[model samples]
Target: MSSETETFSISGPSHLTAIDWKNTYHRRCVVASLVQGVYILERDRQQNRIGSQKALAPLWWNFFHFQLNNMLVDSADHSIFGAIFELKPCLNAPRFVIAFRGTLIESGTRSRDIHLDLKCIVNRLHKSSRFQLAIHSIQETIGLAGASNVWLAGHSLGSAIALLAGKNMTKMGYPLETYLFNSPFVSAPLERIKDQKVKHGIHIASSVVKAGLTVALKCQHKQSKPQQDDPFVVLSYWIPHLFVNPADHISSGYIDYFAHREKMEKIGAGKIEKLATKHTVESLLSGAILDRISEPLHLLPSAELTINKSDSTNFRKAHGIEQWWDPTIHCPSLVYQYRY
Candidate 1:
């Protein structure tokens, strides 16, 4: 991955196919999900909780503690989705701090950060429900486990889910603070939100989405872009020829796309395959779909927080979010047009 871009999650039209996510977040999640899948969702005994590395309580502690330390943690998988969330420590916030990461639909290198290559990897790359369900599981676990001091956070795909969950909980009168990292798509449909419900105490948060100029440089390389029609066919060609730097995979992506295209064509219409193979990363980067423009599925957060160093009023765009934050402390919330 590049210097500033960090990876997390995704799935998309212009995404790569040969990207290996094993060293990525999905690996951690699939392992955890398998633990839970076969797990007897039963609580561990007080003594049982002591030594088991696979114990659920310790896992929660690790999950939350990672957040407390401002570190990102991965999510579980079934169709094998992945996510990242940073749980901040709650000194006296009066509530628990819970985090949920979003998915990337084909954004980065096979084993790199989403921030570096947003188009190489892919997952629930939109504001969709299946992604929402992944976070819903986390919520259910949080309540059942009695892990208090929760503040929800998400990086990319999970960012949108975190925003919506927090906003919905707020409207339902549930006290919560929402933070979305550098998300691409708008979190929720505007009309669905209520007026006073969002205004009272539940605050909407987000940051501005920005991009680095070099991203344009990477995409601008014509020789580096793919020229194939099928991803599966491309993989057939490149899988045997491994490269040293992951960045090289971007140029090699054309081959992966070709193979993936052929594979999908065997079953489906190869719609995404057709789209992925046709364009150069440079072309997409030149437009709105930058390979590193605020995480393809991430949201710029706009939340409120009063730091002791500076008051919230002093902060212009108090909750304005950017792509830099792995799981930003600020996020966007849907506030509908007010009605009398």
Candidate 2:
């Protein structure tokens, strides 16, 4: 195995018993790192020209007492996008974890993954075969081991897939515990602003405009009001764990996303914010032009947002999956629960 794959061992202590799985922070860090192992496993598969002498899956998962149950393959490019890890009997972790790898820029699957990324930008990722396979795998896992014993995890593009799958399963009355590391939020990089006042001002202006548009669309019958049991409304009750880095623009928007909602409410604009939160600019524009309603993949009604406060100037390092597992980083988190 290459050195890249070797890094998977650094994710946790040499022995499983050394760490406390009951600790929320430790568990979150470990789960995030296991997702990294999936990334390495896929990378090794893509680069390995000859069959390896040692097994790859066991190398990473066995340390955590989890066996690789299945490999999630991308039908389009024949790339390994994710894997299902089944916990050894009597382990403290979830019985099964379904993990997806993000866009691997240097791998052969790059083109296919990037295509899906584009699809995600326009909210068409659900129609892709990869996502279909992911959801199917989740459904199968739920059937085998109840939802409580299942976990969903991913990074970047993979995180987006996990998010969608989690949402669908939640709508079906099965909500799985999910860990999304550096999940891409397709929107303006509002979190990039250095000045708090400027950022807050822009957020207020944008929220008001979006709320106004949403109300106008409803008045003109352009957008119909969602019923009481709408999937998005039901999704409010299924809160996933979202890990983000303010230094990474792709995922950092989530910081502003959740923060702005609270700010709007404090200013007595809660009603407007609520209306705007139901829709996205991309979805509304696409619905008008294409005559089809689509929800933005990144928007979530509720989430436990964990922000990594580590100072990293490099974008690659900032957005990397490895950061989540780094023991030295300072991570502050908050839970955003939306009430219907």
Candidate 3:
């Protein structure tokens, strides 16, 4: 993330409201679940549990509708992993999904260590030749062919890269949907200026001092471009439905913040406040999330997320991609709605 992206400069993704509500909700949920599968495989890779061959057997075994098309391993850095898959939601209609894996948490003697360095964000934002070449290679290999709809899905650090990729692809005239879970703030400039943890455990131990240095190096290397021309700015205009657990310290579960709700309220007021005046942004946001996915709001009773109170376990579970998306354990509902 950069100073230019202090606020979401780009809009969200195309609303899924144009489609059927039930199908939309199902699609969003399924996409998120499939994305979780990718994260699982990465975790397996990190733990050295992967056997003789690397396969998406986990995803295939877990999600029947999702078919792995190709595994995208960055040739420059084998550690970076992503995948392209085809999903048949209903009626066997295929939806192409491009997903990126998040940071691998390395188990340590005390706390877990994040494997992917945050500096990658600065490099991605600066459009480093190496990063750009890798992205171009992915595009060439995937070569969006006969794809009626394309979605960019990622969790945590992967979400940051997906945000950049989605915004750029949209600017290039692609109508792409996106789903990000427990996404970290993408602005390096903003993080440096704020000097605060935007997301839980995200401001790397070294980042406190190095963030400024990272920004300075980027500033010196790249010529300034108009803010509007910046992809992140474009991303702010598109409303991508970001699924975050309210208890997720890693993402800071900012969605439950009163200020965040207030901001969302303003966006609804301008567009769909016709439903009711008394509804808070949190409530309507649930509806909007459903609508964007073409699903009518069900307004189900609120549910409690059963997370252990211990710090490490809690953080791990709250930030867990699978736990966050699990309907049985975590359901999207207004905090107030549930309490009352």
TM-scores for candidates 1 onward, in order: 0.29, 0.93, 0.54
Give the better candidate number (1 or 3) by lDDT. Answer: 3
Q: Candidate 1 — which residues are off by over 4 angstroms?
A: 1-64, 67-90, 93-97, 105-132, 138-142, 145-148, 185-340
How large is the C-alpha RMSD of every model relative to the true structure? 21.4, 2.1, 15.2
Residue 282 in model 2: shift from native, Å?
A: 2.0
Q: What is the per-residue lDDT of model 3 for residues 1-340, given as tens digits with 9 covering 90 to 100?
A: 1121111112111222233425545555566555655655555555554552543335421344467676655444444357777755544334567777676543420121142434442232324332364356446534654423566777776665665565556556553566666666322222223333353133232222233433333365453657665433433345455555545554543332323223334554312211221232333344344432111111111212123222334666667665543334535433312111
Q: lDDT per residue, candidate 2, 85-189, as tens digits?
A: 988655567889899989988758879989999988878899999999999999998999999999999999999999999998988889889999899998887
Taking all chains together, the TM-score of candidate 2 against the true structure is 0.93
Off by over 4 Å in 3: 1-21, 43-56, 60-62, 88-94, 106-116, 120-134, 141-143, 146-148, 186-237, 253-313, 329-340
Clashing pairs in model 2, backbone N/Cα/C closer than 3 A: none
lDDT for predicted candidate 2 compared with the true structure: 0.82
Residue-wise C-alpha lDDT for candidate 1, range 1-340, written one tens digit per residue = 1111111112111122222333322222322222221111112321233354433423433422332222222222222232322334334331333444333333221232343224323323333444456456546544643433445554343445554455444433343444434333322222223574452112111100111233344455432435442222222221111111111212212222233334545655444334433233343454445433222222111222111112234222222222122122232222211111
Cα deviation at 241, candidate 1, in Å, is 45
User: What TM-score does candidate 3 reach?
Assistant: 0.54
Better structure of 1 and 3 per TM-score = 3
